[model samples]
Target: MSDASVPKDRRFPIGLTIATLVAFVILCGLGVWQLKRLAWKQDLLARIEVLKTAPARPLATVLAGKGDASWTRVSVTCAPGQAETLPLVYGVRDGDIVWRATAICRTSAAGYGAILLDLGVVKALTGQPTPAPLALAAPTQAVGVLMAPKSLGGDRAATVARFAADKPAPYILMVESATPAPAGITPAPLPAEISNRHLEYALTWFGLAVTLLFIYAAMLWRKMRS
Candidate 1:
C-alpha cells in the first residue's frame, strides 16, 4: 500500500545540486594535491636523514656544485669581519618570538664568497622587538648544515641586499657548533624529526568529501519521498 516511486510533483534542486557538485570537486582536488605533497615531503625527509649522517664536507665543495648542498653538513672556518654589527631576522623559537642573528663571515677559501651564518636566536631581547645587532667578537670554526634562508623565514633578497657592497654566498649555514661559541647565542641545530602529515590531511579532506556526498544523497532521497 506504500508508493515506492519518487514523487513526480517534487521539483529537483538544480542550484543546490550544482553547488554540491562544485564543492565535491574542490574537496577531491585538495585531497589529490595533498597526496602529491606527501610524496615530495617523503623524498625531502629521506635526503635530510642521509645528509645528517654523512661526514661533513667543505662548504666550498657544495657551493661550487661539486656536491649536493641542500641540507648537507659542511664545515667552514669563519673569520670575524670588520662589520661591528650583524643582521637580525625576525622569527619564532620554541613558541616564543625571537630574533635570529645572522652574520657574513669571511672564508679564506678560493672562489667562494663570504658565508652567511645563522647564529641562532638572541638570548636576551630585553623587550626590544627588533633587537640591536650583536657583535661577532671571535672567529668561529663552524660545523653545520647549509640551508636556504627563505625556508627559515629569511628574506633571501633582503639578506643579499644587506651585503650588496660585499659578495655573499648563495646559501646560509645553520650553525650547529662553533669552536669558540658566540656569547649569548644558542645553536639552533637541525631538527631530528621533520613532521610529515600530508597523508593525514589528504585522508581528512577525502573523508569530508565522501561525507558531503552521503549527506546530499540522503537529503535528495528525503526530498524525493516527500
Candidate 2:
C-alpha cells in the first residue's frame, strides 16, 4: 500500500493508547507498592530480632502499667489456682469437636499480674470435658513472653468480653507456647518477639506508584511512534 494509505487514525489509536497508559500506570503503582512493603517488612523483622535477643524486662516496665505497646517476650511461672483454665471453641473438626484450653496466669506483682497461656487443644466425645489442672503454686518462676492483650472488637466482641469478665486481671500475656509448664514453673529462656508489618504495607504502595509511572511512560512512547 502507498504511504498515504497506511491509515494513520490518530483519534482511535491515541484514545486506546491513553487508556492503556492509565491502566498500566495504576497496576505498576500497585506492584511498586508491594515492593516497598517488602522492604518495610524486612526492617520490621530486623527490629524483632533485636528485641528477641535483648534482656528480659518486667511487664510493668515495658507497658508502664498502661495498655499500650504490643509484641514482647518474657518469662513467668504458672501459679496454682492463680491460673484459670478456660476452653476456647475453635469449631468442629471431622465429627468430633475440638477446643483449646487456655490458662490465665497471675504474677507476684500487684496490678501488674496476669498472662494468658494456651495449653493445648482437646477433642471431645460429647459434652465439653474439663481440662487437666496445672500443679504449680504462686511464686513459682515460669518464664514467658510479654504480649499485648488480644483485641476483641468487631464480630467476636461478645464472646471475648464474656471470658475477660470471668477471668482475673492479666498483666502480660504469652501466646502459642510450645509446651505447658507446671504451675509456679519458670521459663528457662525468654520467648520470641515480632514487629508490626505496617511499614511493609506502606512501601508496597510506594513501589506500585513508581512502577505505574514507568509503564505509563512506555505506553506514551509507543503511542507517539504509532
Candidate 3:
C-alpha cells in the first residue's frame, strides 16, 4: 500500500534552491532589458531613416546636436588642407566590392571644430587606392550624412582616435560635393538604415529566458513530488 502522507525527511536542497532562484531572476532580468533595447533600437532606426530622406541643412545646424545625427544631412566648406584621409572601410555597392576612404575635415567654422568626412567609394578594381589624399582644388562646399566610425573589432573610441585630425567631433560625416568626389571615387550611398539585427537578438534573449524559467519550474515541481 502507498503512503498517504509525504515523507517528513523530504526537503528542498538549500544550495540548489538558492542557485535556481538566482538564475531565474538573472534570466528574467536579461529578458526585460532586451525588451527595453528593442524599443530603443526601433526608434533609432526610424529616426535615421527619416534623416536619410529629409532635406539637407547647414553643417552648423546639423552639428547642433549629435543625438540623432546618425544620418542627418549637412553641407559644409572643405579645402585640401582641411581634409585628411585616414583609412578605408569596405562595403558592397551595386554588386561590386568597394573601399570607402574616410577622411577628417576641419570645416571653416571654428566653433564647430572638425568632423570625419567620408570622401567616397573607390572600386576594389582600382587597386592600391592610387594613394591620392583628398586634396581639393580650393575651399569648396560639400554635403553629406553624418556617420560614426564602425569598428569591426576592438574599441570604437580607439578607432576614432586613430582617424581624428586635430580633435574632430566624435562623429563622421559622409560628404559628397555637389560637383564630384576628388578623383578615383564615387559617392558612398548611405547604408540601409535598419540592417542591424538588435530586434532579432532581443527576441532570442527573451526566448532563452522564458525557456530557462519553464525548465526550472518543471524541475522544482518534480523534486518536490519525489
**What is the clash tally of candidate 2?**
37
Q: 42-117 in candidate 1: lDDT tens per residue?
A: 9888887797678888887778775446788888987755645656777665667777677677785546657778
What local distance difference test score does each model get?
A: 0.76, 0.47, 0.62
- Candidate 2 segments whose C-alpha is farther than 4 A from its true place: 1-8, 12-18, 65-68, 77-79, 82-101, 107-113, 119-140, 148-160, 166-172, 175-226
lDDT of 2 by residue, 1-226 (tens): 5656665742235566577667766756765666666676786567567766766565446555555445455555545564343435342333444443445555444344455554333433224454443332233444445443343111222323444543433433433333343432223222223345645665665566667667767766676567
Give TM-scores for every candidate, taking all chains together and pairing residue i with residue i: 0.81, 0.49, 0.71
TM-score of 1: 0.81
Model 1, runs deviating above 4 Å: 1-9, 66-68, 108-112, 126-130, 137-140, 191-193
* Candidate 1 lDDT score relative to the true structure: 0.76
Q: Residue 198 in candidate 3 has what lDDT?
A: 59
- Worst lDDT run of 10 residues, candidate 2, spans 151-160
Please give the lDDT score at residue 136 for candidate 3: 34
